[model samples]
Target: MGLYPDDIEAQASAIITTYRDRGWLIATAESCTGGLIAGALTEIAGSSAVVDRGFVTYTNQAKMDLIGVSAATLDAFGAVSKETALQMAHGALMRSGAEVAVAVTGIAGPGGGSAEKPVGLVHLALKTRSGLVDHREMRYGEIGRDQVRLATVRTALEMLAAAAQTPA
Candidate 1:
């Protein structure tokens, strides 16, 4: 089974097709979604033509090591913070051949809820090789664990589609 919910398959396919049509490769950096964004894209048959790679940085160390996220950013704002998401997006773009990179980080859980950063609090970022960066903060509320993750994947896919529409 693909990580993408059935409702999102068409969107993912469309984005992948658009990227391929434009000769643009895509990369993803995932944390709470656990690479579902990449999984969704790869589900399309022609994804290999547009999907460069995906970085699954579940742990803070992995984010720093794989995506070159700065220790200072993580320390100052935590993993789910926008600062970290920006770094993750940029890091993925820097490390990959893809021209556009999308990143997601959040707490998708029945646990891990704090007053400030509760469950379903996700941060997403998209960056292009031409130095365009967009960041979105999502508060999906305390929906069920599965629901939160699915919602995050949905949002990321939509953002990916929008990012693909932008000129590289």
Candidate 2:
């Protein structure tokens, strides 16, 4: 069996097929979801042609150092904010050879939540080298850590598929 559920695998397969057909590559910058998004994409055979790299930037330092997320952005808005998500996407796009990049930053937790940014809150962003950017904020609402991460993976795959299909 694969590492993810059938539904997620289906989405990942679709993404891989779509991008591969277009001769495009993908990169991922993940925080709360860790590298699960990348793992899901790579689960599909032939994904190496479409997926270039994934950054598992679980810490603020890694986000800045690895993907080039600005320290000013992190300090102004916490890691879970939409700003960070966008920057992560931008950074991943800038740093990688991929034409399209996706990023997720969130509090997927049994803990590490606050009044403002609670558990199951995720911010996702997608960027294309052609300058298309899309962002989504999902509040999955107290789902278990594993559930939240899986949900993020599913969403990221969907975004990649959509971006791949969009006319450049």
Candidate 3:
């Protein structure tokens, strides 16, 4: 009922607390979820201590320009693929002061569904400066656009927390 639901607020709070305690920062590279992941994290007070920046790269050009996702990778794997997600996370990590970064690229829609790449199919990647890169593909299957986006945000928050807890 708030800006973010209770579960999202809890997850965001946990991630922010853990990262801040570890003296770590986080950056987000977001596509279909736009900046919702970043928004959720920053919604918690004292987030400035842990959130470095967020890249809302909703377009291929924006992905390349903002986060350095390679054009070749985009051409080959499409923006929604695990490859682009990894590149986005890696690029965000390399570009920002954050020790941890998470990237999301997906087709969250009522119109962009295909047999191979349907709506609600999301690819997420998390990268740490200490050389850990994790990727996950989620198939939510025709859920509404808002639902898919929110799911991606929740998953991204989970990833960030997991990465922060992992030994660097």
**Model 3 accuracy (lDDT, Cα):** 0.93
Number of backbone-clashing residue pairs for each candidate, in the order shown: 0, 0, 0
- Where does candidate 1 have its weakest 10-residue lDDT segment? 1-10
Poorest 10 consecutive residues by lDDT, candidate 2: 159-168
For candidate 2, the clash count comes to 0
lDDT by residue (tens digit), candidate 1, 1-168: 454667788888898889899999999999998978888889888899999999999999999999999999999999999999999999999999999999999999899979999998999999999878899999999888888888988888888888876666
In the range 1-168, model 2's lDDT, one tens digit per residue, is 788999999999988888888999999999988899899989999999998999999999999999898889889998999999999999999999999999999988899999999999999999999999999999998989999999998888888888987886
By summed lDDT, the worst window of 10 consecutive residues in model 3 runs over 159-168
Candidate 3 deviant stretches above 4 angstroms: none
Task: Report lDDT (CA) for all predictions.
Answer: 0.91, 0.93, 0.93
Candidate 2 off by > 4 Å: none
Q: Candidate 1: list runs displaced more than 4 Å.
A: 1-3
